[model samples]
Target: MTTALDIQGLRKTYHNGFTALKGIDLQVEQGDFFALLGANGAGKSTTIGIVSSLVNKTAGKVNIFGYDLDTQREQAKAQIGLVPQEFNFNMFEPVVEIVVNQGGYYGIPRQEAFVRAETLLKQLGLWEKAREQARNLSGGMKRRLMIARSLIHQPRLLILDEPTAGVDIEIRRSMWEFLRKLNAEGTTIILTTHYLEEAESLCRNIGIIDKGELIENTGMKQLLNRLDTESYVFDLASPLEHLPATSSNLCHCTLLDPTTLEVAFHKEHYSLNQVFSFLNQQSITVQSMRNKTNRLEQLFLELVEGNKA
Candidate 1:
């Protein structure tokens, strides 16, 4: 597939001398759901700002569908839609007007814009609220309104920043389903969310940024594989003294009460069999056994902490 968004060596710095982004590189393939993950103050927003032309980059290159942002500004911007984290519309305006206005700004014809606006509002389950004042809508409804507004221009690539932040679980899941359908039909999506589970479930490619730097970028499966290793747990029969301070093989362990233990291990350096053998020799009876799947959250934490070091 072709690249929908290509960013090379992207960098941004604020006037107060705070570097918001540092030499970041990223690419979202056409029709792929790419997730950009990062903590607060990470460069996720700055990267989106540059791509959306909301902020001027101190240095770097951004291309939307091979159109250079600097040289083909209008064309590049035309192909992208950004639904920001915060609402940015007149509270008194009717929802329909706000959405139609976005289409107008993109130079879409009025009649066509009206049709598109209605279509999206209905598809996003907001057609009934289309005539309502923006300030009267609930948080989740406001988010859906933003999504509907962004699509009015028929953008090929949609940049969603914390899209489901304030939505209820049902609405959030519905939005995800809608986005998934959109991607199936042709839109390339770039999503940034604090919810790692959302990214892990929806995004095929993942990029993690921390402290102005891009720390990890790879397929979601590849990232999870990188974290696969030894797994063992202890079904303690009773409370005991302090456990080992650290272990070369044990990644970490937590005491889950007086009779339960959760242990994480690295398979390359240790084996569950060895753990079981040791426990057996110590006469610790196993009450049950369980295995945990490799999670993106664990890898995210490791990457962020390692970069800090």
Candidate 2:
């Protein structure tokens, strides 16, 4: 597969000697829905900032479609669109003009810009308010507008920085559907969000970063499988008078609720069959038995906690 975005030994450090990003290497394939996950103050924002040319990196290389970012800034930027975490447009400007103006800055002709702007406004469900001042729009509307503005040049790679951060559920769902459709249409998407469930559901690949370092980079399915290897959740028949003590052989078992037992074990040593056998021998009937899927949230916690340790 062709690479849409490639980073090699990427590093960033502030003047005061604060390291924001370590030597990180990553590749985003063409038309991929890639998710970047990390805790606050991790290099997530810095990574996006460098790719979007908003932040200067202390060192490293970033290439977009074979074009080096620093050497071919214009061409590289032209092939990418960034929807920042904050709305940066002039609030006094009309919504349609704000989008059209962005196209103009990209050297797209006025007529073409107008056509694209109109289409985007309508497609994003903002056409009715196209003539309204952006300041009059709600927060969700502002986010939709920013997305429309970023696509004025129709870039192949779209980087969304916490795109659904402050939006309501309905609006976030709408944005997700829109993004999914765009990905299906061959646009590569790189998203950084706190919503791990969203990333697990939408992204094919994921990268976890911590304290400016890349901790894990792998296929989403594989990462989740690592978490599921020997984990199980048992919906018990009822709350027990005394909790079942886990032996050293049993690994870790946590009581998530009165009726749920979440357990994790190493597959090489333990199996779900063993769990069932033990429960059966104890004559404890289970309401349900299911694998406990590993999530980005859990992976993130592990990363941060490990770093602290």
Candidate 3:
């Protein structure tokens, strides 16, 4: 597969002698929806800043779609559209003009800029408020505006940092759908988000960064396959007085509430069907059941904490 982004032996150090990245090597294939996940202050922003040319790297090379950042700076940047973590636009400007002016930064003609701006605004569901000042838009609308501004130049690679932060569930899911359609249409996407479920749902590949190091880079399915334990939350039809006993000794059950039971078990030994059978034997009719969406969250914690150890 063709590489969309590549970083070789990337290293970064601030003037005060703070090392932000330590010889990191990573890659994302063309048209991939990749996730870069890390806890706060874990070099994620530093890595992104360097790739987007917002921050200078101390040592190492970065290539975007095979365009070397050093020798082909304009070519490399032209291929990427970055929606950074902060809202860097002018709050007083009309929403539509903000997007059109962004295209102007890339030297796009004024006439074509308006066309692209309209297309992006409509696609992002912000066309209705195009004439409104950016500060007048809701939090979710502001987030969508940033995305529209980023895409004004129609870049093939989109880098989003906390794209859905402060967005309500309905708006967040709508943004996810738009992103899915964009990725399906052949645009490569790199996402950095605190929402684990968002990563698990949208990204095909994931890389975990901790303390300025790339610890794990693999397919999302492969990373989740490393889990030996799986957990589920079961809501009971009636109030529960005690935790139910599982036939398998490896299974651990906890009472989350009077009517909620959480079960964690070695997935290899105790199949989900077996768990259901055991519950049936105990006459515990479950009102509803959901597998914990935080499986990746648990693995992420273990990996970061284990790296410290």
Candidate 4:
């Protein structure tokens, strides 16, 4: 499979002597939905900016779908669609006009751009607001508009930087579905987000940067499997007073509250069934249980902290 994006010895240093990238290398195969995650100032946005040609790279070879950024700049850029963290379009413009205008930058025929705009707007649930001024739409609608604009050219690769920020859960989930469909239709996507859970749910492969360096890059499932333990929170049907004791060192139980308990266990040594059995023995009844979504967050913290040290 061809690589959708490849970075070799990428480095970036600003005029203020602030280094944003530390010669980090990264790759994403064509058609893969990948996540580029990091805390603020970790160079995630810088890497993206360089790839999209919005920022000059200090030193590196960047190849997008076999087209070199420096030598084949236009071809490489033509393959990409970037949705930045902020809304950059004119708020006073009609929604359809805003989307179609983005296509003008790529030299797409105005008539064809209108057709593409219609299709994307309908797909993104923005058809009803197509004629409305952009500023009249809700925050989620504005985010969707950016996405529609990004895809106007139907580029092969799409880069999203915090695409769902500030969106309500319902709208965010809908956007997730739309993105999933886009990826399924063979558009390579690289997402950068502060929402760890969003990354965990949507991305197949992951790269985490910290302190201006890439600290971890691996398949999502593979990285998750490396985790030594998993934790779950269970709400009790009745009040429970104290931490529950476990027979094996593999299991650690803690009382989160009078009616909430948390259980941590080694994967090979314990299972949810065993936890249920143990609780049965204690005459404890569980009202509900949820897997703590912190598995990725936990590993992310470790890798980033390790990089710092």
Candidate 5:
């Protein structure tokens, strides 16, 4: 039940009088894998900047692991590791040096830093290129290097902003596995990504921000439960000239193709058993079935649109 991060009445305004955050409030529990989602200009980056001390907040409070950021800046910072959206490391520095040097900034001894650097580099698949300049590494390797650098100090809370933005699918999946392992080992993580599917798969709780306001903050399952209808695509064993008619008004059926059908229904009003019975009555055998859209994506869109209205 310990809190890893807490933000109260946080606000930020730029020089041009543009407010990036409007009395925002958030809390993250220890060991929780949380997702902070927003569209561009939604103040996600602004909030992160304030938390990391890159930008001064106009008003409010930020606490990291019970250390007040204002009174105990160093202690608060020592508990956070940030992997920004853009690569900010020295391009000319050797990959290993970049990571090892970060440890020094956190007061870690040189010898211990070297050992940690080697272990992280090897684990992230960057040991072979440890001596190479960071600029010489591929885009994916650069991203991995950033992650390795962020973890050099072994912070309790890690915040990743668009960590997989430019990585390929295979590399992205590998990073997902690595992050999952890190979370399982008790690191509280805050993830900001445009990939709704990634958030849905990896996070247990979600907070969605839009137009400098937090629109939704709740457990992932709770948000998903608000969705009354779910659409599914069913592949049939045999082709048909048309979709079979069903007497149940609770379900809406459509013919996607000769051998494919789409069924949408309210979760409370219908069940898979009803769908199966209807298909059996029409002599249609289902080969397979899958969701038409990701549950999280559907709810996210709904929340964003509701906020807009």
Candidate 6:
């Protein structure tokens, strides 16, 4: 019930007269895995920067875990750990030293910081390379090291900005699992990534920004439910010369090939069973089926496009 992060009437404008955030308002509940989504130059980074105190906000009220950022700057900052999109650590520093030194910036004792650094390195699968210079580690290893450094202070709220960018799928999945575990252990996380599937799988709530405006903010399920229609691809068990007719007039079917069919239907009017039954009646046997597009990605595109209109 407690709020982890809150922003009210937030605004940011550059000296060049470009507005990056236009009176934005958002909140993330304690213990929630929340996603902040937007296309490039959509103010996602600016919002994160302000929250992390890396960039100055033109005007706004920001509260982190009940501490107002203006009056309790240290307290608010102490509760947040940010893993930015770009790597910011010293390239020449040893992997373990980078993480250990981060804790010192928060006034953590050097001995305690070293212990926490080792633990995090091991947990993030970078312990074996603890002595290696950050510049020598692979891209995925660098990413893991950044995450480890972020966790050195053991902050209650973690903000990740495209944490998996440029990493391979295997490494990305590993990072996701680690983050999921962290969230389950009560560290509220706010994630911003181009990968909508990652958001759909990891976040319970979402806020989408477009052109300096917060266009959508709600439970993920509620947002997905707002989608009126969905398309599904069904692989037929046998080849078909032409398309088959279905009873539901609300559903549209197209044949992409002899063994493939694409069905588009209003979610409110048609069920999977209805589609299956219709295909069965027409002697079409399905081999497999899948969504035509990632549900979250489809909805995100629509929301951004609709906001433009």
Q: Please give the CA lDDT of all the candidate structures.
A: 0.87, 0.89, 0.94, 0.94, 0.94, 0.95
Question: Tens digits of per-residue lDDT for model 1 on 217-292?
Answer: 8999888888766455667766745553444545666666767777777766667776776556656666886755
Estimated TM-score for each candidate: 0.84, 0.84, 0.96, 0.96, 0.97, 0.98
Off by over 4 Å in 2: 228-294
* Residue 163 of model 2, lDDT score: 91
Off by over 4 Å in 5: none
Clash list (residue pairs), candidate 4: none
Q: Give the TM-score of candidate 4.
A: 0.96
Judged by TM-score, which candidate is best?
Answer: 6
What does candidate 2's lDDT look like per residue over 1-309, in tens digits? 899999999999988899999999999999999999888899999999999999999999999988999899999999999999888999999999999999999999999999999999998999999999999999999999999999999999999999999899999998999999999999999999999878987899999889999888899888776653466789999785555776665477778887888777776677778877767776667998876764667766776788778
lDDT of 2: 0.89
Report residue 239 deviation for candidate 2 (angstroms): 7.0
Q: Give the winner by lDDT: 1 or 4.
A: 4
- Extract clashing residue pairs from model 5: none
Considering only N, C-alpha and C atoms within 3 Å, which residue pairs clash in candidate 6? none
Q: Indicate the worst ten consecutive residues by lDDT in candidate 2.
A: 241-250
> What does the lDDT come to for candidate 6?
0.95
Where model 3 places Cα greater than 4 Å from the true spot, the runs are 240-242
Residue 126 shift from truth in candidate 1, angstroms: 0.7
Better of 4 and 6 by lDDT: 6
Greater-TM-score candidate between 5 and 6:
6
Number of backbone collisions per candidate, in order? 1, 0, 0, 0, 0, 0
lDDT by residue for model 4 (1-309), tens: 999999999999999999999999999999999999999999999999999999999998999999999999999999999999998989999999999999999999999999999999999999999999999999999999999999999999999999999999999999999999999999999999988899999999999998888888999999988888989999999998767778888999888889999889999888789889999999999999998767889889888878878
Candidate 1 structure, TM-score to reference: 0.84
